[model samples]
Target chain A: MARHAQKWRDAPALNSGDEVNKASQSMEARVINPRSALLSNYEVLSLLQELEADHLARTKIAHRIKKEEEAAGTDVSVPIGGGRPSTAVETLENLRTVSFEAIKYLSADHQSTTSQTPEAVTELVKSLESYGFTKAEKLQIVNLAPQEQIELYVIVEELEDRLSQEQMVEVAEHVKKSLAAAPSLSIVAQPSHKPLIVKADENWDATDDVDEEFDDQGEGAGVEGDLDMEED
Target chain B: MFNLAILKDTVAVHPADFGTPQELAIMTELNKKYANRVLHDVGLCICVFDLTEAGEGKVRYGDGFLWYKVVFRMLVFRPFQTEVLLAKVMSSDHNGVRLSLDFFDDIYVPIHYLPVPNAFDPNERAHFWHASGDAEAKQTELLDTPVTERMWIDKGEIVRVRVEGDEFYDDEPGPVKMAEGVQVVKEVQTRAPFTIFASMAEQGLGPVSWWATAQPEDGEEQDEIMEDG
Candidate 1:
């Protein structure tokens, strides 16, 4: 249970000095980098956000065109088939939504935060690297702020045997101490609304003015530009 | 959460265990073969409960071992759709929240299923639900002090989740290598044997604290009726 190796016979004898050393060595050797295990959380999210916003924006245009066509216009929407988004799109959107809800918080979101105190978490993450923790693992540790050894173990249980029980306990104690010393968690401001147009590329905005009465004018709901929102 | 399932398997008995009782030898061999393993049809095998049959051991041709057929009932944990469970929040992030039972830990709840009008606190690294009077919760809970409306699930908090579905992925092959002049297999796929896709998208679901204190939602004695680990 403490290690990932499933085959009992392959394992070094359960409780021996050599077995302990082999356990830790085998753990690191077998495990993959945490980054590879990352999900399509952020990419799929931003993609669906862009896709839905795109679909909605396009639908609004098609509706307006149809209304104008009724007066004295053409059938531009014919080639595009239906006014509604494609079934594939709808199905994917549903699956993505359901999957997103279920798989959320399991992985980190790609959006880099322009938090005022980024250095605190960054420093802690960097310090954790020396202890054989991956970047994702470190991020998780910083995020959790685990208060007890048992709680900390839950996060690293996949590789629990890699570090001695004493070492793990020490690390857990260190995490608790660091969290206690750090300032209280600050309030997170609501993310800015960027337009859906630039979602894929540079300077994408996610404005919430995705109403039907959208004006095809200067810019759609250009309230405040996301100054910090930029490409990595 | 718990169910009995029958398993049929053949066990190899070595001469080293000849001194031990045949039943004991077979039991040890059977446990070693199946414990902590996931079967596609049976979900996950917790332990061998009771043996229905332990066939007589037959000597092998060349190898100094006996092959025995064992029929046994095993305790399994295979969550069904809509099975409400009590789990602890393993961690929370912008994408959603992760909950874990002691035996299994890959349960997830996405943002869409979260309480109405919740936002991810990037700095805090946890998602929060802002129950509001207005349907469109324009104000951020962080800025305002809607104490009762603002419900947050921190790490390690006990949460109630319903099993939406479960997924099984065949263990991918591993790299082949030579060890001690013999071929060795390096298979370390951390893919969870049985990943349970669950949702906390209901009134009785979310953190147990809310439903535990407030009147039970949908009027179904949810608290007492929850069949969980």
Candidate 2:
């Protein structure tokens, strides 16, 4: 982490204080600024995959060069970020099976995911917004599939008087109905929409209840987007 | 950020699967063989995007399986260094707060990496940062500022972090961390395959709530209520 801090401190943007500077080399830091949005699981895993991918690419070239140098009986070194390359056609392979396992670790059920087809969950949340369901509330409705108001209430307990039990049930029912009516809607809703293509994680672990437990960065521009709704 | 990476691999077709069309069999085998694997150098190889090249299968050796050489692209995760990212607090202990991005949950921002003058409250099982960075000259200017003064980052707080460095030395555990020749380190080998060492001690790089002026969402209220309860 100190190496990482040194790498960061080298950046011209950070030249504030000695404490911060020292801590930069000390350990990974934590913050509580509300402006920081909570990253969903998919977003995070995608990043890790990216980071790992980068590492692999660099390392492969480094190792390949090192191998050639070794064959030439010359001392060689693989640079800091990389070392190790393989067959000519054998590029670094991050087997989808490997990443998907990580996603499955988060949640195995394919049906209960946030969206049946990527955009559906976001669309459902957007459509429900007119009906007064917050994004978090709607996500809960889709993820949990609460059969009754009490189950839905378990998620939206913070609504206070904003939504009555009847409204809660109504919203939950509406989400389910939309999903049922639009199992293929995601395909049609945003025909050109391509989800995080390499996104491995399905959704916040059903047990995670991302909104309930984690401080999700509620970036409004997340998955949910406005779309032309097709009715029954 | 997610990006398309070109990946190539050879997948084998079993006798049962050989009944399908060559392309379909190769696609299924490729999907089965390549999905969800992470190559330390390339990145996490996601599902096969599309095949760029596919070779005729051969009944190689005595394996009785047909091997097809296939070239394809898969989605990959590869964030550049210093890229700002968001992570969710997973657990807090004396070591530090463990962060997760759901699928990739091995991020750790050590106590030292936290804002200076922060302390871990064992009772609360959270870390608190005493606000003191802005000078008085800066503070007085904020007398009427609409920002909610933040105190600490408790468990479950969402925070933006800078990708400082990645730590994954694919070496067997040394005696120090070895339990009878097996690595005893739980977080590294099992908790997460990769640990993203991130830093939030920088400006505009901590919890978004403190920096953003948006009114608190239900998550905030839920935490407050839970804390009180």
Candidate 3:
């Protein structure tokens, strides 16, 4: 058994020299602090948006430069100052693709982020200071504008133990109020078409009876009110 | 969910990038190395947040590239355990559900983690909840139930899932194999380096539409229950 163990160790020892050489040749990146700070979805979205815009601007400049060179009758196929000119562009493209994917993922079905501003988020955070929620919980509450108590419960662990039902309701109310204060472009854009369609449908149905038409108009107004509330 | 991770790396900037600003060049090099890549145990790195420290550039004996040790904060997509996140259902099977956040598509809700009393329907190629009043109801009771009566977690539906855990697998190099006298490097099926385990068993989870439509009624029921309790 000892002889077998000795051979096994010897086999690995031979390969260790090669492994060390490879390790020294390529310096591996090290993680200093894995959890330095948490970033909200809104913050990430904005950062990605900025990166996307920068990529677009860079691409435009590169395109313009290429055009100028082509017009000047220079050999445009060959890169002008060639120290792997393609690498920079390739890296930029990769960044753009990744950022675009992340932005799409972050923004999809997340209407709260559309109108979320730093000021509004800070104000909301300040209002929820009394609850003594953790930073992660607060970030989540801000990211997902929890409209109901059930949604709020999912964000904050041990919800019943931490806060009473009334407190939960109050927190939800605070979130709703803060979200409402922010001017929502989607809410504004949403109502215009729905009410118009309802009105158009009512006109088609109640053309003959005047009294029924008035009643239908009142029903349409109620529907419009419900639609508006839902948008909020 | 995202977080800032401070990472240190030695970045070698090529002589070509010397014309650009030092910070810009370093930033570009860092992004090239880290962006869209998964760091074992750390998470998927998105981009460098900011450069915190940069050591003096060193000239190697032969290489023209200037190397600088950089310490920077990187924005990474690492959802915390039990954190609530909204993701779209990519597909469902006997195993459970697969979810996608567009950029990260390896999120999975295993069969055990799905809402209790849930079963996979082979006909629909999707898993669905029985939605029966009794949590203890058997699978046989749901067999005769109409399709509309069942709450289906269909594809393309947005769901709220709580992060249960995560896994990181290292794809280490394996020994080459010989097949029919020709040495064949085995075609290892590439797996996601980082995968998230999520659960949708709690209240307000599952498809967003499920709660969206039933929210008012659900709230009223909860209020009644609270009062009774």
Q: B116-191 in candidate 2: lDDT tens per residue?
A: 5555666567765546435332323433332234355766666766667775545554455667888675554443
lDDT of 1 by residue, B54-146 (tens): 778877445778877777665455655655556778988877898876456778887777766777776656766655434466436453644
Model 3, TM vs. native = 0.78
lDDT scores of the candidates, listed in order: 0.51, 0.49, 0.74
Predicted complexes: DockQ each: 0.02, 0.06, 0.31
Candidate 3 segments exceeding 4 Å error: A1-26, A73-81, A84-91, A184-232, B178-181, B187-189, B213-229
Model 1 misplacement above 4 A: A1-232, B133-148, B174-190, B215-229
In the range A1-232, model 1's lDDT, one tens digit per residue, is 7355555645545445575574345323111111122211222233333333443443344344455555665544343534432111112322223323322332222112212133454455655666797644554465444444433543453556678777776666656555445353221221313332332212212123322244451233221232111110
Q: Name the runs in model 2 displaced over 4 angstroms.
A: A1-232, B133-150, B172-192, B214-229
- TM-scores vs. true structure, each candidate: 0.43, 0.45, 0.78
Give candidate 1's error at residue A183 in angstroms: 44
How well is each residue in A1-232 modelled by candidate 2, as lDDT tens digits? 9999988878744554554564345233111121112223333343334433422332333344445567879553433344322211122244433453444432333224423434455665566676576544454455544444434444453554777666666676766765565443222223222233212122322223323422322222123231111000
lDDT, candidate 1, residue A66? Answer: 53
Order candidates by TM-score, high to low. 3, 2, 1
